[model samples]
Every structure is written in C-alpha cells, then in structure tokens.
Target: MGYAQVNGVRLYYEVSGSGRPLVLLHGGFGSTESFAALRPALLARRRLVAVDLPGHGRTADADRPLRYETMADDVAALVGQLDLGETDLLGYSLGGAVALRLAIQHPRLLRRLVLVSTPFRRRGWYPAVLAAMAAQDERTGERMRGTPAHETYARIAPRPQDWPRLWARSGELMRREYDWSAEVAALTVPTLLVFADADSIPVGHAAEFFGLLGGGHRDGGWDGADRPASRLAVLPGLTHYDILDAPALPAAVLPFLTHPVREPT
Candidate 1:
C-alpha cells in the first residue's frame, strides 16, 4: 500500500495482480479490505487498484465534507497520478455512486463502468433504508463498534476515534437529495449495473435504471446487433449489504470488463 497526495488528502491505495488496471472502490465506512472476498478472483485476471476513500480506512479525512462529486474528483486525480488510462472502474454501494460520478464527470478516464447496488436517485431506496440512512450519526457509529466494520476500521484507520466523525459526515452526504436520471441517460460509457435480487432499491428501479441506459427496450435481433452497450444483472439470493463480497459479483463483472468495448449505436 502507498499514499497519493490528491485533492488535499493523502489517499491510500493497494496495487495487486498484473494486467489491465481495474480500479475498485469500497463502500462507505469501508476500506480497501472490504473487497477481500472478491480479491482472489479479481486479481487473477487483472491488476486490482483498490483505494480507501476519505475518512475511511488508511486515508485521512479532509476538511471538506464527503460529497460524491469531490470524492469522484479525488478518484479521477488519483487515476491521473497513477498514469492509468481508460481503465475499468467498479464500485460498491457508496463507492458505486462515486464511480458513477467519475464516469459522468470524467468520461474520458474510464473504459468500462460497473456500479453495484447503487441507486440513481436517493428516493430509489426503500423508505426504511432512507430512514436508517437519515438516522445515521455518531451514535450509529458507536453502535457499530464490535462489528466487522469497526474491527477493520480500528485496525486500518489512521485515527480510529474519527470513526464517529466519519459516520456523521457520511450521514450528511446521504441525506442530501440527488436525482441523476438525466445524467444516467446521457452516459456514453459501456456501463454495467449490478444489483441484488433483494436490495435497498426497489427491483422496479433496477429495470428503470437499465432502461435509462438504453437497455430493456426492444429485443436484440438474432445477430444481437440491437443490444445496448450497457448491461444490467440482478444476482440471485443476495442483498445490498452482502452482494459486494459475493463470488457472483466478480463472475458477473469480469466478462464485461475483459471484453472489447461496444460503441454506442
């Protein structure tokens, strides 16, 4: 692992395997270690560039709050600092939103995009999930102690005491309203949207998101010439919380990343 000074923060990242770069971003309150379960398979086929986002894991918190746009900018800068060109980028949950922002805001930086268990609109999430997100604060962080997330944070964070502060900032970011439907429709990347059959976002929203990507429309002809560059997969027997680590995650994504990019028709 090494640190890269970008966007006024020392970002920590780990590089493993060897081949085309595949940058992986973990979820909120999570470090690069969040992808441990998927690492073996991922590293086998491509170089894995895993990063710890601000206020989480080894990366220290900056003075600014955690907004997707800023975080995306940080990530885009990191890619430039690392000299990675048109790489495949995959992000889970909070990371997924960042990946989406990066793809939309820095379209030239990415070759293929995978957003796992992310919603284009805040309201796409279940009402209970939104309530829980809004309720997150320092107390929520304290309550999370003794859990796997806390254990990892305590082991890898620069200042473990900042855990509560991280939660507070994350909660603030989450509560803010955002609707990126129009932005999603305009994306030119060869994107893949992955979600659990049972997820925080309603299943209908998954189809709607795919539709916005020019998918789920008319059937492709026998030659499959009419298919959109974007794809969507709803993995079976998984939930938003666990799908990140599921073997199915890599199984579904590796093909998309390795295949030649399909230009938008």
Candidate 2:
C-alpha cells in the first residue's frame, strides 16, 4: 500500500495476491477499505489493486473539481505508472461511473470491465435519490457528521476536516448532467453490469444498459452461443449501500472475470 503521483494528485493504492490484475474502485466517500470484506475471497483468485479516489481515504483532494472523466484519467495514469498492462477494471457506485468513463475513454487499457450500482445517465437514479443529491449543500455535511461515511472519512482521510469541502465538490459533480449511451454502445471490451434487485437505480435501466452493451437483444441458442460478451446480474436481498461487500457480489462477479464468453453465432 502506497501513493503515486498521478494527474496532479497523490493517489493511494494497495496491491495484493497474484494473477491477472484486477483494479478495484470504491464508491463515493469510500476508500480501499470499502472492499475489505471481499478482499480475501477475491485475492485468492486475482491480484487486487484497490484505490482511494481524490479526497477520499488517504488521498488528498485536488484543486480542480472531482469529475468522473478527470478521475478516470487519474486511474488511467495510475494504471500506466504501475505498468499494469491490460488489467481488469471493477468499480462500485461512484467508482462504477469512473470505471465506465475509463472504459469509454481509454478502451485499450482494460481487458474486462465491471460496473456496480451506477447508471449511464443521471436520470437513471430514482427521483428521490436525485432530489437528495440536489439538496446537498453546506448543511448536508453537518447532517452527515456522525454517519459511517463521515466517520470513515474522519478516520482515514489526510485532512478529515475537508469532509465538508468533499461533500460540496461531490455535490457539484453529481448535479451536472451526463448521458453515455453512445459511449457504452461503442465499447469493445467484455463488460458486466451488476445491481441490487432494489437499488437507487431503476431495475429497468439495468436491462437497458446491458442491452446497449449488445446484450438482451436475442435468445442464446443451444450451448449459449448467441450470448453477448457483456453480462448483467441483479442479486436478491441487497441494496446499493451494502451490495459491494456482500458475499453474493464476488460470487456473481468472480466467475464472469474467470470464464471467457463464447462468440455469438
């Protein structure tokens, strides 16, 4: 576990185990520790490269606003710095969006892509969730002071007092509008979209996103020959907040990473 100077911020990353490199991107307000629960199981099969995004965990914030595209570039830079050629990318929530950006913008850098609990468009979030995001402001930080997210930030962040700034900047980033349908449709690498049965994102969007990746367009013939390279899995009895660390997460995800998809006929 160490820091690397990438895209102007000293990004924190931790590497473990051995095999094909798998980069783990945590959700908003979370750090590498976010995957602590699944690390052991995942490490057994693949080398894990977990990271802390700008302003999260031990990584300090940059002067520029935290945008998915910029963070994606940082991740790409990190990957280059580490000489992790053609690694798999897996991200949860906020990280999911960043991973999507990386896959869309830096296509050649990834072998496989996994996005969890993230939507391609801002409108994909439930109305209430969007409303809550819109209401984020100075007061929002104080309201979150004692919550687990705040506690985690306070505990491990280089500047714990920057929680309010992080919240405000993140709020600004989320408030912006974005749609990546064309980009998702243009992706060439194998992809997987994972979501909870009941997540902040609409269930229909999951199918829609998968469809954009050339999935759900036709029936798989005998021996599943017609399946698209992309896959989707919605785990039961989970929610967006805790789905990342659930046992079912890696159980559903690891096989997709290990098993190669057959070509469509």
Candidate 3:
C-alpha cells in the first residue's frame, strides 16, 4: 500500500509489477482492492498502479461534494505527482467516466485508455440509489440486492460502516453531469471499450457509446477526424457483476494496453 498527498487529499494507491505504467481505477463502491483478481495477470507485463478514489478505501473524504470532473483533476494531479508520463489507464464503471474526462482535459498524460462497463450518460438509477442511501434509507440496497452493484459491493467494500459514506460520496459525484459522449469522441489516445454481454447498463447503450468513437466515421454526431484509435469487445456470458470473474477479461485488455496504437483505416 502507498499514499500520495495530492491537492490536500491523501490518495491511497498500490503498485505491483514492472514495465510501462498502467493505472487501474475501480468502480463506485469499489476500492483499489477490487482489481485484485486481475492485477497479477496485468502485473506480469506492466507496472500496475491501483488507487482508491476519494471516499473509498484508505483515501480521505473531501470537504465538499464529489464531482467526476474534480475526481479527474485529482487523477491528473496524481499522475503529475508520480511523474508517470503518458501512462496507460484502465477504469471500470464510474472510474471509466473519470478516465474519459481525463483523456479530454489532459490528453497528453495518457497513452491508452480502457473503459469497462461504463455508460455514456449518467443513469437515473445511480442518483436514485444515492439519494436513498444519503437519507439512511435501505430501500436502494434492497433493490440492488440481486444486482451487479450489490454483488460488486459485497466483494470490494471493506465493511458495513464503509458503505454509507462511500455511497454518499458517490451520490455527490453523480450530481455533477458530464458530456461523456462528446469527451470520448474528442479523445486522441488509443481506447478499448469492454462490456459484459449481460451488463445491466444495456448492450445497446454500450454500442451507442462505441459508435461515438471517431473512427473513420462518426456515428454519434461527433467529428470523426478527432476520434482516437479504438476497439470495442463484449465478453460473452458475463453479467455486469460477473465480468470481473471472466477468465478472458484481463487477457482481452492486456494486449490492447501493451500494443501500439493503430491508425484509423
């Protein structure tokens, strides 16, 4: 475990393996520990930096509400602090959103981008769950019981006490809207979009996001010329929650991270 003080926030991060740097950003309700299963596989080929975003794991909470753009700035500051120039980034769900923002605001800092199960638009369910949890309500948890978020929380969250605060922080972050489609369309780094076949976010939505990637033709209204080199892969038989358990998940991602970026055909 390691800690870096960035913008008055003590960010908790873990490092493993060696080679080109690869930062892992976990989803909401998840900390650096969430990447444990895939870390070893990735570590073999590159250095892995896994961090707990604010309000998760060992990172201290912010004095104000959490926003995705703010979180992206925090990541940008951390990368500069660590002196990791043009490193690869792998972000899951909420983390993916932050990664997209970073790619837009600070494109020079990233060499490649990987997004897992992230939606282009903020979903209503996320805020609804957050509002309920903020009021100390259990209904959202009850509703999420058999869902991917619940299963993911069961695996990554440290304890019961840790959940509410994280949920509250996530709520604050969700309140801030982002133009993900536009930001992603403007990205210049190589990108790999991964989604589970049975993802709760809907395959159509994921496809919509993929279609936005400016690769020769812009299908989602953004300039295709500004689109970065990209690829999209959907894991078969995997649910939003079970994607982490997919044997081919890490394998599918590793090559994309290590390979050189290709020009749009």
What lDDT would each prediction earn against the true structure?
A: 0.93, 0.92, 0.74
Cα TM-score of candidate 3: 0.81
* lDDT comparing candidate 3 with the true structure: 0.74
- Which should have the higher TM-score, number 1 or number 3? 1
Local accuracy of candidate 1 as per-residue lDDT tens digits, 70-132: 999999999999999889999998999999999999999998999999999999999999999
TM-score of each: 0.98, 0.98, 0.81
lDDT by residue (142-176, candidate 3, tens digit) is 54565555565555544544455555566556665
By TM-score rank, best first, the candidates go: 1, 2, 3
Residue 166 CA displacement from its true place in model 1, Å: 0.9
Cα-based RMSD of the predictions, in order?
Answer: 0.9, 1.2, 5.2
Model 2 C-alpha lDDT per residue in residues 113-199, reported as the tens digit of each score: 999999999999999999888787767988899998898889999999898888888889889999999998888889889999999
